[model samples]
Target: MTLRHHFTRLICAFAVSACLSQVPAFAARQPGPEQDAAQQLALQAQRAQMLSRYQAERAACMHRFFVNACLDASHKQERSALAPIDVDLQAIALRARMRAAEAEMRQVQANIAAAQTGQHDSAQAERQSAARATALAQREEQAAARARQAAAGASKVAAPPPVRPETAPPAPRLFPAPAPQPAPQPALNPAQRAAQAAQAQADYAA
Candidate 1:
């Protein structure tokens, strides 16, 4: 009977413990706006510090004999330490993106609703789209004009200058002017020379 009573007490204790476990020990804390802002600031500061530390460690590793190994080890350590921070940051960014997407969807739906109610007109939307297209075309045209002008300028700068023929000094004679031929030798006597001269004069006359 005592053993049975002891078992009954143990069962009762277990049931009570189970019930308590089903209830939260304390109310779950919901972050308020102020807390969220503070947390964001803290995270930003932490991110900056972490990046700074990583940079310092990387710089120090560069001085090591086995720089690649040192840097790899530092990167592993940094990654391990920053994993949680990165996850939190990614979660925050994803939540913001989701909120933005939801807002955009709501806006689109509202516009559709307004259009269904005749508050918006298709023609007006078409006109706006046309205006945006016209603006884009004008911008593109202006960009193309600027590009053409730049190309022209670059072409002008890159083109080689016209070649002007430089006057060259007269070429040296290949063969020296024949030395002035010596006066014909007086191979014959003065009388023969006079006779030859007379014969030349007679030929010229003829």
Candidate 2:
């Protein structure tokens, strides 16, 4: 190459290398979504600046006597400058995809936990409802028994008392009478007594 071509090639290589070196390295810690987006924007801006510089160099190379040789040198420098920026962009895209996958997994777990809780609550409610129904049935049975007892008592009170048959009075008892005795003779006076005595003696002698 001529002295002038050598000078031009050296200047272009140095400028491209210096510009690419100005791009900052990624931090050790993983970046958040906003940080990733900012990094991508900054890298893209640097890439655009690098391309613009290469285009200007290419235009200058076209006017040279060794156009092929100048163009080849410029293309090599452009590739070297763009290589690091492309690597950083790829890393950012990969991290973003990982973050999205993790978020989706957490959401799925939350949905499963919510469904389990709903099932448990539904079972508890059903148990409470069944217990209430049992209590109500028992109360109804007790009321029915009390009503039956009350009806039986009322029936007994409404019934009339048993009646006794009427009977005749007892007849009086009759006894037989005693037999009658003969009447006693009356006593006479003194003369009548003596005549009775004489008549009794004469009758005895005869």
Candidate 3:
């Protein structure tokens, strides 16, 4: 039995002892009431009725010739009657405490789970942030390299090619270029050619 059971029994035993110091008018000749009371069928009302009956029995026992014997019997009966109620009370209290403990355990587990989830989420966020930073750094490096290449290309396009030193104007081209010759005249037609021949003969005769 639990501590509560022992305590309840101790208390009920004390109550029984107290009631035993009574007269015959309060004595119980039969044990039926004890049996019925032990069932604790109706806890509050029945237990009260049982206590009253015991008190009446103790009163009746005061009138007995063997008062001590009657009182002893009455105490035994009362103890039996109250035992079931005490056991029931203890069982009920134990069940309630167990329920409370179970609820507390569940709450603690829920809190732990929540804490774990928060940590996991925080870790995931940190990882994402790191990945983004790395990607951004790579992009910046690539952009810088591209900009440098573009600047080099632009410079190459803008600058002119190098020129060599001049020589003595190619030595004045040796002699100057000859003057252009006149074009030759075309020969005359047949009649014009005859006129020109007759003119030459007349000149020779003169």
| Over 4 Å off, model 2 | 1-28, 64-72, 163-206
lDDT of 2 by residue, 1-206 (tens): 34455445445545544544454442345788999999999999999999999999999999999999999999999999999998888777766655665565455455556667988999999999999999999999999999999999999999998787877788877777767766777879999999999999999999
**Where is model 1 more than 4 Å wrong at Cα?**
1-38, 63-65, 119-206
lDDT of candidate 1 over 32-56, digit per residue (tens): 4455567667887898898899989
Q: State the lDDT of candidate 3 residue by residue for 1-206, as single tens digits.
A: 44455445555545544444242322432224344345445676767888999999999999999999999999899999988777654444444444444455555556666767999999999999999999999999999999999999999999999897776555544688899998987979999999999999999999
lDDT of each: 0.70, 0.79, 0.70
Q: Provide the TM-score for each candidate, comma-separated.
A: 0.37, 0.59, 0.46
Quality of model 2 by C-alpha lDDT: 0.79
Alpha carbon lDDT of residue 102, candidate 3?
Answer: 46
Candidate with top lDDT is: 2
User: Deviation in angstroms for 115 in model 3?
Assistant: 3.7
Q: Total backbone clashes of model 1?
A: 0
In model 1, how large is the Cα lDDT of residue 83?
82
For candidate 1, report its TM-score. Answer: 0.37
Candidate 3 ranges with C-alpha deviation above 4 Å: 1-45, 52-75, 157-164, 171-206
